[model samples]
Target: MKKIFCFLLILSLSAFGFYPSVSSASEKSQQEVKEAKQYVQKHVPILKNEFKKLSRSSSLEDIESLIEKHFKEYPAPQSLKSNKISVFDAFPEKQHKYEKFSGKSLNLNNLLNDIKTSSTGDVFTFESKDNTVKVLLGEFGDINILEQKSISNPSVSKAKTTKATGIQRQTGIGYGTYGTKLYTLWCEGNFSYNGKTVKVISKDGDYHKHPSGSILTLDPRGLGKERDASIGKYKYKEVFSRLRVEGVLGFKWGEWIYKARTVETYIGSTVDGNIYGGLKSYK
Candidate 1:
């Protein structure tokens, strides 16, 4: 009797379309999937595209050009923009099986030396110029080029100021909801600190976003001025030019953070929506 009752209950649920399904893909659905795959192929040309190999006969210019070409083709996400290439060994040193580029500076001269000499299986890592996406080239002399094409965006690249400066692109991330990119900008400008006007250059990514924010107690004092001043927004143009940043303020413990305080803006550069971190506070 109990089994009969259970069977009836299941039958009732099935009638309401609650049973498991193993439906075949419809013709339209199949076409949509094919189209999606094609779009994905278009989205990331770096991985599918084949790179020309370097040879002993390759010149310094030739090698540089080849690597630059590959970097150009591989699209980087925003976070990985404006960064230098970092070099490392492709594998553990087995009696110095590979000659790694361990030069300290990211200067172009060192890069050329590393590339001109590194043998097969050596690795060179660097962020792409535009998107700052990481490029890990295996076998530097005879290289294997690779870039990011994953679902997540490219990571933030640590790079010095490029000719291109400023921050912009304030838009809504979702329907009926506006989104703002919260971050710090480095600028050399005149600002008022504790009631005195001063000109200074604050570190990058410390342009506090608000007049009031989370506890400064956690943040080490003296990095920049702490304030209750209204930190403002960066216009779209500002992001592209006025704002000097390596990347966006990303996840902190899996949560999005948009905290700010009075920070620095370039002296004499009046930008909308920012509380400049004035001259470094010193004892």
Candidate 2:
């Protein structure tokens, strides 16, 4: 049953593709959605009653809550979201080999080979704001990320030729520790060194600051462990300037770790490809 659920989940997610223009197919669209719901109830009886119950209700809140319950109530025993990243916010000893680099978004096979770790059960953690989830080096896996290109934006990149000892920090009224401002760049723009672009983000490369040019000193090192403050002890959303994740994917909505064979990195061409900030990813 669990295997069937996973297969169905992947199928449904991958099936979310282009639809006909609504102007001429509004009724057909509505009918298809209804039929899709019926198909689920017909095959998955546990959802049968809930689907009927949801159909009679008109409140968005109720609909959302019901949808959540639909998955929660599934028979499979799954892990729920952690209250804290860890009880004391400490990370486990690193088990997988890690690497960090700035390069074009390539295929999963290429990325995996680039990592050069042949251990079974190995995973890749692209620290960019998006691609840090750990995925097993399975001969066969279910996550869609592995097949997708440019999923992570370089959330935090350092200077290439830094003469200083640490990243530049500023005290501003923003996120993380109250009144703790930092002069860090989010994963929104490109970073360059010398004449060639050195940094790349997964998306939003056109709307933010782009330096006419400057020299940078980019480093290639495996990320270190950073811990989250426990519970109320945390005043803001916890973040890691750098990290190497080692974890498993989950089936629930709250599970941030998704499984797929392909993932993406920022490409300089993608940044240059944007016309008036209308950048897009076709995968």
Candidate 3:
């Protein structure tokens, strides 16, 4: 009896066309994929050279000097230069305390080992004696240096606090085909913190005035939640202000294909002894 009921439910869903078939509708083509792979292969050698230099450094001053020289030769991104966001603070770390090598001499072997085992998009941090100096490394090979003075430590306030409020936006761009004719797809919208409140900003680039089948959707990350808290002596207000882009291609039979990517930028500040804003992963 249970099997019959389950079968009937699946049949009803199929009749309604709830599931669409997957196809070779990805935004990137085979050639583009090959080029991307080749780029990574060429970039690995440069990364290894830099890592060797960093690993051989005898002291924190040497590491700082090397980073400064490298930055002067190849400037950092505008966003990173202007914001000075510690890569360490921007993302969460697998380990909290640097207890393993707390008082010992600085060793990057553990960090290197962690990076070898970590997948892309993973973030890791290693600190020197007394947490005076920090090295933030992303699995994708981006690295940053942070000093103790740059880290924020806000004091707690006695007054009650209200939930954080902010706005978010998303933009998408990709291509699709309608029968034999090709079309470019694009969309953008502004939404409230929780993503429940939405306002379509634009939906241009579509050639068809009234296409046979079309669909656009938004998927919000780290938005609309009650994530306010207070520690022993510090009151922190966390906010996640970033942009996520998702592109879609539609077929004549009401089938759709999607490709999504996120561009995250976290800007934080402290004022009047209270932490007004902070990193997305900070608690």
Candidate 4:
């Protein structure tokens, strides 16, 4: 009877012993899981709301408001020990502002037509003929090209500036929504007019060097045999006396980019030595 009582007491103690410890452990585990779920439930809405706001905002203000709202509701997780959000979190509006000038906004074809009919075309001649043998800028879009007949133009202008100066000479054209970084369009072709020959020059891509002095890269569609060849090379050249046109263009500035749409042509050069090439209508 004593042995049986001792055995029964041991069995009862063992069962109860596990019951208290396991119940306590299970309660703590459940609490932890509940807290985690609560944290996720709170923060998920914040992230979702911000993402939606970002998608709709054309300007940066809306995005910023959403970010501030999120922070108020979902403080950083405490388990992280140290919580720091990125500067982007501090100024979410800046994202849109930063992206404002990051892509092309003008229709190349339309802008070309706007410029061609807008001017008499001769107004694009380089004023600094003493330093630049030839400079031609489109008065329609951010497009320009300069050729140093002998590479000895006092201080040879940087390629982008040379191009811009030419564009600036145009009366009605201005930089499109892309803002000023760097835009280029160049081309070369052969044409015969009235028995004399002329080399037509044009450009059609963004060729601006970065602040770090790097040129922009090309996408698959932007890349062509024309881009791979040198603008200075004679291949794109055309010897047309009456008026023939050809050239390539490249553009780049910060995150903005553009390309020439209409092929370039030189007009009114029956005299042969006079240079004439400018952006024209697509049709």
Best by lDDT: 3
After superposition, the stretches of candidate 2 with alpha carbons farther than 4 Å from their true spots are: 1-70, 78-106, 109-186, 190-243, 248-267, 270-283
lDDT of 1 by residue, 23-48 (tens): 33332244433433343244333322
Best by TM-score: 3
CA shift of 83, model 3, Å: 29
Name the weakest run of 10 consecutive residues (lDDT summed) in model 1: 5-14
The sequence of per-residue lDDT tens digits that candidate 4 reaches over residues 118-206 is 33111112222322212112211112223211111112135422211111111111121111222233322222222233222332222
Location of the lowest summed lDDT over 10 successive residues in candidate 2: 1-10
Counting clashing residue pairs in each candidate, in order, gives: 36, 17, 2, 42
lDDT per residue (tens digit) for residues 100-154 in model 3: 2222322222332354442422222333422233343322233333222212222
TM-score versus the correct structure, for each prediction: 0.19, 0.20, 0.26, 0.23
What lDDT score is found at residue 115 in candidate 4? 39
At residue 84, what lDDT does model 1 achieve? 14
Q: How do the candidates rank by lDDT, highest first?
A: 3, 4, 1, 2
lDDT of 2 at 225: 15
Question: Roughly what TM-score does model 2 have, to 2 decimal places?
Answer: 0.20
